[model samples]
Target: MAGTSTFMEVVKAAAKQGSAACDSVAIRADQKSYSYQQLVSSAVNISRFLSSEDLNSSAGNGHLNGACVGIIAKPSAEFVAGILGTWLSGGVAVPLALSYPEAELLHVLKDSDVSIILSTEDYHELMQNVAAKSSAKCSLIPSVPVGRTEAEKAPLENFHSSHERGEEDPALIVYTSGTTGKPKGAVHTHKSISAQVRTLTDAWEYTSSDHIHVHGLFNALLAPLYAGSTVEFMTKFSVRGIWQRWCESYHEGIKADDAITVFTGVPTMYTRLIQGYEAMGTDLQAASASAARNLRLMMCGSSALPYPVMQRWEAITGHRLLERYGMTEFVMAISNPLKGERRGGTVGKPFPGVEVKILEDESGNDAPGVGELCIRSPSLFKEYWKLPEVTRESFIEGGFFKTGDAVRVDEDGYYLIMGRTSADIMKVGGYKLSALEIEAILLEANKDYGEVVCAIIVPEEEAKRKCAEELKPAITLDELCTWAKDKLAPYKLPTRLFLWDSLPRNAMGKDEVVIKAKILGSKLKQNFDIPSEQEASNP
Candidate 1:
């Protein structure tokens, strides 16, 4: 049969190129390395195991159709194998996070309607219970054996030759982080995945020579692998582990083939890495900085990257951290360019082939200036799972996905993400204030505030004690005033401040400040005996 040439086909092709040419490392987990061929063989073996169990069969049918396989494994070679195996068996790969609670796990399994669960030994017990509750069969992903003999090896054949998959066929179903309400599954098709992989590979210039120290899960790992780059998994986010790995790559006597050249992380991860760098002794800091400087690229996203944090990071590492904006709906749409001037405060231009426009209020017209950022991209998701009305309402007149983010473009044509239009924009005395802007200023004032969330606290509450407890800012009222006095205008600044241990966030890592404000606003008015809007406006 002719070679099945696609993203998965690339893996098979790499395998046929022999142990030396395909001699590249595929995964680095627990300080050990696994090669590309091993990954392929493991995936094949996993597929065989699934076939043997007839897990893919429905009502005793021998053939496996498009069964959903729930993969509950840590980021490792096994996890990769499980995903590829599912794909090879014509099954849907559902990547489950280890961070999910049992209830959350059950919810995802139930929603995806997974037929079977393939998990690592660490998660065997947990998944067993989840599978029982969801009525899905469970199995342990067998470890790939080393040193395959001729007799043990099956004849190399094109498994995907019979089935031709289009780009729009669903390849993965990734759940949102679920910081606020219930988490929703966002589906990405083969084409979108291919587009994203190509975009990232072209943008970052990922090559076989590049060893990417991937800090996040699923998309981050798969994208690099799809681009034919080596991916080292950091299952746990450890500042020391990351810095030490970078240093080892550059250190003497340890001239390893696997040198981490690319790094991508969330805002929180970067902030922690900076803090960790600060805590190190001067000599270690110098070495760490030098090692990090040698890395080809470092990118940040998933949340707004504070300007202060970006500035500090550049000063310390000698590399300007490239900040971009994206959501789960589309893996990525806008990015700060890899070669050009990457602005610290802005998320740069639209990605290649992506079209963006800002829509104005009242008129609902495509205004040239500032308003809600709407996106039209080939990579945009099909729809929210099961939410037909939401799916219908999310698009604009031109089929552009309404981003729900308020944004503007600078003279340089860089896109600046103001914040989420609904939750991050606050109305104060007829003026609109950006909560992200205020939060950025607050981060600058005291980096120790860590995860900062700014919201409008409306006035009125029945219980004074409860109101006081819920409506206080993390920083003292005096401190907040002193901090904002110089940075913001009288109207742009937040009048009401409420602080808690942390802010409520939704699945996409967005804070639900609007909902909080509505609750707090009602309480504040009642407590202060303030007049209603009608009374206040009339009087």
Candidate 2:
């Protein structure tokens, strides 16, 4: 229902807006726009195309009959239509990342049992080979079609309505990969997808003029479109390109007609933007800061936003970064209030219809009141695609899904994410520390990376250059502890430190999701300890 557009009745409306239409749903980096009418036309055409491929005669006597349709395309109107078309045809849309390698692509295609791959022309060859290997048919997604004339729109609605999927029917299978595990596809029904967009729309109060950029389908693109907002696509992320767009929005204090009003990013993007801002001359910097300040909303997620970065961005832009906690399974759960206090270092309380529990009782932890965060929400995924056992184990007795991340509530009731239970949590003596909290202070690499309260730190390039110029160790353990002791607890400080050139990241043929800690931890040389006398006292 969310994706459905008023067909023939809206033809005159779309034609009035011209090529830059979606009533301005999406604008590509190159400045091409697709109207809502065009999207509906393309979706209808795609649905018809798929139905002709023997999908209409499937079991359930429905189009596709719940087959998986893998979609490979860059963020564009075509991508949106691909999803809408799959839903219209009663197929589950599996959006495959172009960044995934051949083997990884094959794995996903096979895992989801994708019956067809609707890839864009650019990826047709790649997807075709992969589809062949996976025993799946491959077809290039039709380009976003032109909207029909006023008379034509009336007939198109019924043409697509015949293949309408039920609310309870499977609509999407989003595959989420962690730093150190095989990808797991989370199945989402049409109802769940609708709920995700509605919750985001309600919480964020997305308006048509609130131009936003973020990640994930529902958060970055779908929810905004659902709220009648214009979604912009950047061909590739560029620190300079983003700042210029914000400047264009509010240049020298004049807000452009299509000024970007909302922005979202990870900590790294903000860090780079800060660095880019600092590099600017006083004149340009002032203009950039002023333009950034004009934005109605700014957000950060996908990971924790560091306090230092958050503080500096606020100093420059005058916008407090709204930090949130979410997962691929549910999109967004807890968030700092839109009009209330957005506390730093914590993701705020749950949404209106969301239920969250801190399951400290199950963890048997040394850190009191810290445990896995469990959530039950309307936007919650239906199940893991095909992994019934894993799906069942992921929930608790009360239908609350166990989020493996450890969380604790502050006195003000704000939720502070400690770290992931399997990866980010480290046990030292009688104390358990969050690696994310430590990483926020000190940074890491190589086989010498320690197993205990050890750190493999890669010094910043400037710091490395400065140390190399002086012909000394980049940073000594004494120097680090002396600097870090004021910030971290005694036992929480890294006892063993390895100064490395770089950390082993997506090296050794592993994907980007491979946990560097697991790789580093496995190859750990030894653990070192400091004397009790040298311990940094915690207040």
Candidate 3:
């Protein structure tokens, strides 16, 4: 990888081609397109400003020279430019999520030791306050110029080329999702960035016409840009907008010029999309289904995809979501192949050049086929920022990052991630159980006839609606157990259910509190926030 083209080099090459193909769109945001030339020009301007500020600082280097820069912007040309400018000036880029609350935002700014904050105008005031708290300077990221005439273009000077820095030089620091644990900054080197984009570009067959976005930074913008593909930004997730976009993609058997060819998302997104689909009328449903079917591919990850959601989506759209697995430590490693049979409930084999192993239990005892999943991949992050001991402890023998996930391989070699060792694996009546496995199965089904399974309950909208109409609980302990009898063992099914009005959740949408309670013998209990006067049996 030392001699291979860096991520910047790949992007720059694409930008150069934009000189002749001036209309070649690089990014689409806010209902407008920005060409690659505009991106490069804007990045160069930011790089110059950053360089001059460093030169003016008596003790600072001539350029950023590995200083950390915090970027805050919606998915747009401005965001891309900020990162590029940081790289061109020999700095590390830390992207701050727009969803973060004030306290969480403060934590990231302080944790990353950010020297400067570059944000869009929308967040200028907020970023200014946060940057001051962290003793970092805040600046407005320049808006990238679009559709500039050839004569109006200014030459870029002193821009660092791909060869200026080795692939191992640190490039990006993306924080962990914090779904299972505390968020940590996982630093990725230029080489790792290059590896990920190339790995994804090849694995998914990303072309100039296609658009993808499961991993927005990598899959949508960076990787697609490297492959000279146009990136259309959906800054916010809108059910109606997404469905309308798909419908607009193909109409009357003709592909729209801006039709999306490929897309990726999390399991929650797929579930939402399915909800959106089911809510559509018959004529609109037919159009959406047809458009989605014609798309080159659709994929899901970031959590276990419920079996029923997958089944229903396939029944409607004929696309079996290519579920994959990865984390902040590594952008992506294992996935169901694009062309092969997508096995349900499995996150297919490791990508080419990626290696993985399932480790034995921590108690010096083998647990048959199930164990912690460890990964070693070219795209693996360099380290957890500022946490030497934690970083060292994260990996095991042979440089493998010991992912705390529990997983088992199926007969066909596909990996099924059970869940995090501490967060997901459960010992119920001395039997090992996977909460994720149980959830994927349980979320797909439930029936009621006065009998029940008292599991952790988050009844679906449909269930609630039915209960409202019938004036009876939609699910009971006996009904759940009976339905799950063949799908899950007795020990795996929850004996107690907590049906809260609405559980508090963290930014990553993980439950924050369980509201622990004693389980009395099976008896009828008042439903929490039920739309109807329904009765449910509880343990």
Candidate 4:
């Protein structure tokens, strides 16, 4: 944490070794392959631009020199280059999600006090406006040319190593998905970033020969790149495309040169993939299953994985989904093992250097052994940016970060997340119940309910017709209790139910449970002939 820069170490190593040693394709996207040399070349170019005399003068300082650089680009070579360039120029990278609205983008930009915004041309107009709103300078990220000659490449001469940063310097500021409230920036340092990437690389057995398929660019992209693995990026997640790609990779019983060995995604993606598989014709389903099973690893995270989804996926693909627990504060801490039995409904033991403990609830009212899951790891973020008091409160006396997740350990010492301490744990009749556990049980019990759960409004006339066509009445409180009678304790059953269209989800595919509950609760009150406006006050 004192002397070195983690990302720069990889860059410098690649640079010193030249093409052959680091020459494997580091990124494949949009039907193009980019070598590690090309990626480093592009990053050096961007670094030079950032350190130019004119730009420095305009920015009101000599150089970025450990300042924040807001990056707004889709998952591509440009995004990776931008991050590397920021690090090369002694700046921290703050990746602003493209999925964020203008207001949310501005909020993050202003909150981090970003010195500059580097975005692709596609979002130039929008990013310009966002930059204006946040008072941050804007620049276009030059397209990374493929197979370019040395003479044509941007030189790193103008870039000064005098601004090089230490491991303790801030390297990234990723905002939490604001499902609860306003998003908070979690600041990660170079040391923490290195620890995370190294842990994942060692745990997953990543290597230069492996190819990882990634959707969004967080741990999925960065970790593999750090391990010198080739990363294939998808512009967006498509169940059909994913299956088809896998099928293509292993066509004619031979593995293609660009075969993807590892894949990671959220639980909802798997659920959708299962739905896609089920809808496929017999022959196509067989091909998809065979292709998917050949992949070395499949992982699921971001939200609790439903048992049914995991079971069905394994039944089809033969690979049990390795479920893991992580948060924005720490990229990853606990994960189901790559070699050992990956048990369903439990995130396995801590990573090699990570320490975990279950802090018993002070109320002493929870079910035995249930408490807040706490973690102390080298990979833990430095702080919640600009919120010193909040950051201090988040950790206990021994530097264990309170994860705000309720968890209980299984007999084998694997951790089973009960739910979020605030939102996912519901108190009913003096007993705390995990909404996720209930959701999982409901998903299995109601086979005819299909893939989705939760409520949404529809036309009153059409709603009745649809209910009749489905051959089931709108799921009612009595119906839910009757079905959950044997599966759940009486207190754990849903007291109220409104069968509607769909659930609201955030960008990361996590269900917005708190917001949905409030909306559905309000609608239920309205249906009961109570005033809608009074519902909020009553709750």
Candidate 5:
């Protein structure tokens, strides 16, 4: 591609010089190590196959020329190869989350108009059906074989050199969680993706020395790879497995080659980890804490980090979780400084080279300090795929994308996200309140109640035991109101309370607050004689 270098360029350049680090381990998954050389070789072979007449008659000269290639695989070497191969064939790669249901998966496949679907053998049956339903061809991505002899090597062809695809050409299309509505495909060009990876690498100070333990795909995997760092993948987030892995990494004061130096997860993961720690024995706690504290960096994102959770995690691990802010539209545009104080309940400053504004209201007025957070970044997505009208409405006159998040600058110039304007913002008795702020306080209160507010799934027997064990009565609306009187205004108190073993969450671990609100609204009207919106706002 012209005017900018893709990540593949850096990989190829390092390979050309026969750099030892370039051939070092790139991905560690399922007790297997995939080297950079093997990754590139597999990608090249896949690119050749994609261009062959066997795949499609339209694929002349083996170049995708920006066609869409749907990639379906778990976090593994084959997934990496699929993405690289798509780029090598000049095709746009769209990573379909495995957690999506059949209908949603089919929606995305058809929406993106994917020309081909590449997946591993495990998912061949499912993907073939999806491909058939979406009118796309399907193929199994070959395993990336290790051990390449020098005689078998050749000068790698620059995939974009022949195709007229430029830096602005579409390279990736990632769909959002679609909690509120149908998922929209966020289109990211090569330049935008490079900018995001570079920003994250610089912000997190990623290097070859860092071994990242990734719980999810996307930024976690791609950023480390771009920085030439080793990535250890955990297909599923197991609290026990994570703690055990850290202990094994630093066993007997000996740091292994695969020692985890960095780890990132959502707030729920941290919350679970804290619960797991509390359940450990005294001796086990000491060892787990020591091992976790030894890690160079521990980060959290994808949702707000509760202050109580942060404090408890720091007390246990001696590492204050580095919290950052991002969305599917733009990978990460703001982050707390790696070497500075990470304030709890705040998502630090705008990232370098990113501009932010506050759109206060419908008139596009800029509030003194609080409003909807608008962002213009080099890493911003090109457009929402095939939704030009929606995409056009998403941006302002000067290209700042409306984030739909209400935020304000603290006295120290840090950004504090109030909450999402749609769901988190609530009007009560002529006053506006932030549900997230109240939820944080409620979460902290749960700790004081001396009973863990586990996911509502605890068995009835366990619930009875917990309630009986705690000397205090169960927390009630009145009790919460009394507790919060000092911290919040009268209108900010939660008028209703629904205690559950666990809050419902999407695949990303974010609370399905909007949907829950609708369910709650219906129940409130039927059982509690709750006033309508207009009535509530009046008096």
Candidate 6:
């Protein structure tokens, strides 16, 4: 278990532990519970299905290695089965998000070079069209078998051994959000997956006794399942669903039977949850807070968690939410201590076996203060599929991957994520201000603004819009200046503001401020009353 191994090893180990002791709940979806045995059996069936389809095209020639299988099933027992089955058959599993439209789905399938597409009944039509367009075969996931009576049960004498998958073999191909350009596939070897699972399990103390209600996809799901925790999937992330689930978990007493012990979500989800709690009546708020308090852990990541939101959540739930930092390249590297002070603004120290450094700009050296974040970890992705040049440029002289994020270490050793070095780090009047920091302040000042985004506005465009339609600032310039006067330094306040109906978001739901800035700059030139040539050239 300490060495590098394939994901199927987890399934095999659970199977070898005997049906009774290891026969616990694995996945709960659509009100149906799937036992561990049932999950493994379904994986076996999926393996047979792939064999029948000649996915390997190697009847008796040799084992199937490096073959890619695209999985488009909803988060259910079938999804788990597809992944395990792909591993068992010595194939790479590429989990496609259902949120993707047809064009996006086709792009991923063709890019990954999938030989077969595995999907549930709900996605059959869409996936079938995608497979046809991509010239790939589509297969329906086998139904999980059940209802074997006690009298007919056989002794646990012999069972099929797990697939012989080496640690260095590729196991997963996850695509990036395509925020910068086209999405590129990120390859993760079996060893990397194993390392991430071990790190998360050790850090979070995931055990058979724990049941986590998960709202995220990919790494969040795989890492938890690999550690043998029961994952209850809520296909849709409804605020009502989450609160009701928490209430039901503790309806009886302090000691809950089916209580969810762990929870993880993005910052936006937590923000919405906080809003939901605020809207609740006094009696309902008490119940929601108490139920949430009984949970063992609540983790936030994938984006900067606003300090004000973090403070409000602590006030309501009496639990300090653990904040962490991670990306698609490396599942998770930095996390607040499970048993120590969970800081509000800082993402805690690096996990074991992970080394982090900040590379300064002008000095091109490791500095004590703010700089680019570089990470060297065993859990890092092997490469970006089919992008050798891009992959080569992503790392330093050593094996450290440049995270493209700007960060600084505080006196207490907790790392504060300024934001993405390329976008969120804004240069204003010779001073650098973190957009995330300003957004946090703005959110605190104006709760009515559902989403607040800060970007460097083109002054010329503001002048044009102001003259053309008699446009007014969404938040008065004077008001912002006054509100932020004490909270932030003068250099950090927005000298120029761009008001919009909404911020443009990338595929991953992240605001693309860099692109927005360029677009707005062009519009500013068209709209603003141009200054004289000398003035324009000077400023």
lDDT of each: 0.70, 0.70, 0.72, 0.75, 0.75, 0.72
Model 1: per-residue Cα lDDT over 289-364, one tens digit each: 8888888899887778877778888988888888877777887888888899998788889988899877876644
TM-score of each: 0.85, 0.85, 0.87, 0.90, 0.90, 0.88
Q: For residue 139, what is the lDDT in candidate 3?
A: 93
TM-score (C-alpha, index-matched) for candidate 1? 0.85
lDDT of 5 by residue, 318-381 (tens): 9999988888788898888899878888899989999998887664343568788899999999
TM-score for candidate 3, please give it: 0.87
Backbone clash numbers for all candidates listed: 16, 9, 7, 0, 6, 3
Candidate 3 Cα outliers beyond 4 Å, as residue runs: 17-22, 55-61, 149-152, 155-164, 178-182, 213-215, 362-367, 446-454, 457-473, 501-539
Count: clashes, candidate 5: 6
The order by descending lDDT is 4, 5, 3, 6, 2, 1
Model 4 stretches with alpha carbons more than 4 Å out? 1-5, 15-21, 53-62, 151-160, 216-218, 448-451, 455-476, 526-539
In model 6, pairs of residues that clash are: 461-524, 464-527, 464-528
Q: Residue pairs in steric clash, candidate 3?
A: 451-478, 452-476, 452-477, 452-478, 452-479, 453-477, 453-478
Candidate 2 pairs with clashing backbones: 8-153, 21-24, 21-35, 22-34, 22-35, 22-36, 179-513, 179-515, 444-456
Model 2 is weakest, by summed lDDT over 10 consecutive residues, at: 462-471
Report the candidate with higher TM-score, 1 versus 5.
Answer: 5
Over all chains combined, what TM-score does candidate 4 have?
Answer: 0.90
lDDT of 2 by residue, 475-537 (tens): 667877787788888876655454434333221111122233334444542332211211111
Residue 196 CA error for candidate 2 (Å)?
1.2
Cα lDDT of model 3 overall?
Answer: 0.72
Candidate 1 or 4, higher TM-score?
Answer: 4
User: How far out, in Å, is residue 383 in model 2?
Assistant: 0.9
* Residue-by-residue lDDT tens digits, candidate 4, 97-167: 88899889988989998888999999989999888877799999998887756633434343455555788
